[model samples]
Target: MAGTLHFHPNNLFAPCITNLFWFKLHHHVMVQFKKYVESFPVKPLFIVFTVLFFITPSAIASVQISRTQILMGDVPVTLVVKTAKKHTIKVTRAMEETFLLGKKLSDSLSEFSSASDISRINRSPSHVWISLKEPLSLFLLEKSVKASNLTEGAFDITFSSSNKHTSWADLAIDKHHQRVMKKAAGLKLGVSGIAKGLIVELMSHHLTKKGFDRNLVNAGGDVYASGTWIVGIRNPFSPEQKPLTKIKVKNKSVSTSGLYQRGSHIIDPHTHQALGKKEAPLWASVTTIGNEGPMTDALTTGFFLLPFHKIESIVQQNTGFKVILITLKKQVIKISH
Candidate 1:
């Protein structure tokens, strides 16, 4: 517990330790406080403990929701949000709304799933336009297009679930009607690279608009914090042990795309396959921190597909983004803000 909140002042334990456990302890403390109430010299520490334990400014609520099913791969989806208990209803409602939005976005982007916007487009006949209709779908498509362009097709979304024929160059958007068209008849899209971050963004925005401060939204491993939050980076080699590093972030999105979380080379869009020990050594795991979830999410995947030397231009152009690369040899590469 030395490295825990006992030393860190983030009020982490206040939310994690349940009131039921503290209440039982509170009863014993009250007994001791009463015994020392009349005799101040007897146990002054008991009164202090009782006050700190029971009379907190307010309760903090941390909730984790299990999504009905797994997402892209066999990776199960979980949504977590933390906030002050006083606004429990608001936070819960915000989470509910966010999850619904996530489902819609997932169905639209998942190439593995059929009957979605992407699947329908792929299933469509050649040169036929499929209507995106929904504004959110159009927005996500736009972001994916931009990500592909920004990464020079490294972060392409045109990866089909069942075929390898489609690519970034085959996509086209009609802004006048808010629709997207695929030049290749069987083109499919997968936005899992950036969708996780968008979910975090939406959840954070909804929570913030609901008047909650000190809130955090973590969808699986993608995270965004509106206030000071201590986030842990997963250990690539060891999953059962503690996190490799803990960083405090505020008003930022923290995204880690690697084989550690997905049990495969999730960051590699080109191969759509896991990397071997001798393959892509430096990009074994990539962690990027930024203000936007989409940007952080996009960079983690796009940069992982490129060589370390090739990533210099991206970081040099972006002012606030920071990246940490853990090589296959266990060497650490840090790019400062």
Candidate 2:
């Protein structure tokens, strides 16, 4: 196998600073064999075949074939493509496509950008159907609505709205027309909780469609693994920021939400206020692993704001979901179906 790892030196989210590294032990071995055979005189034809047979397999075996690349932005993204070295061209194209898709999704969902789809939707006249340009935006909105329903309003995108009456229920979605209307005034959608995971999902899907079925896409703390991956749960309270534990998952998504990640960014939908202030948060971090990236992301945020029993009940109801809760006291609790 052959592999390349790329990273930006200034990227704070990258694990290492190496810009690019090529691992081609097989190539090195072939070069060494050519020099050895040229310097020796013994049955050249038979010796050449014998050396090639032994070295070819060893060279291929030593080559690290996976391609791992990092993209730095508001949220750091890591894309891993697992394929044979012969498919380098395909892997390059797949990475480019996935990166472009991720950028588009981020731009469309960014509330800070006035020209973004979310911002345009927010500024649109209330109760009037506004046509959507980017189909990705509409897809995210539909998923947002489903997430709100799944979490029983605990993961509402309308939590950012200042209007007391505004909620996810007031948003009317016309999927056939690719339009939406919010009945309540001042209803603004804040989809940061699930947008990253959507980005991960779409990027992973694009790679898989391009024949790279064994891949991993991680945006911030939201991750989607197409094959088996061993992911670690970070210890938020630890000064060294070590992993408290690790778990192996197959074809699943994992997302972690906590005050440690963004410092009280999560809001309680019911109270319409930032969490972890009035009362100490029950858990320091909530890590959720599930079959769907968006849902896992939403659940991580939702579980952080819910009580233990409520979280447990929700997890039990969803067979595909499991959660790892790290308490303020540093205790780890694992819940699963």
Error of 1 at 147 (Å): 1.9
- How many residue pairs clash in all the candidates, one count each? 0, 4
In model 2, the worst 10-residue window by lDDT is 10-19
Q: Give the alpha carbon lDDT tens digit for every residue of 1-337 in model 2.
A: 3334554343322333222333244345456866887887675886778768766774654212343445435677888876677677778878888888888767777776677778888898798998988887888888888778867888898998979678999999999999999898889988788878877888898888888888888777898988887888877886367688899998899998766685388888888778866656768889999988888988788878778888898889878889999888888899998
RMSD of model 1 against the true structure:
11.3
Whole-model Cα lDDT per candidate?
0.68, 0.79
Off by over 4 Å in 1: 1-85, 112-115, 161-166, 263-273, 277-281
Candidate 2: deviation at residue 138, Å? 2.7
Clashing pairs in 2: 1-63, 2-64, 2-65, 3-64
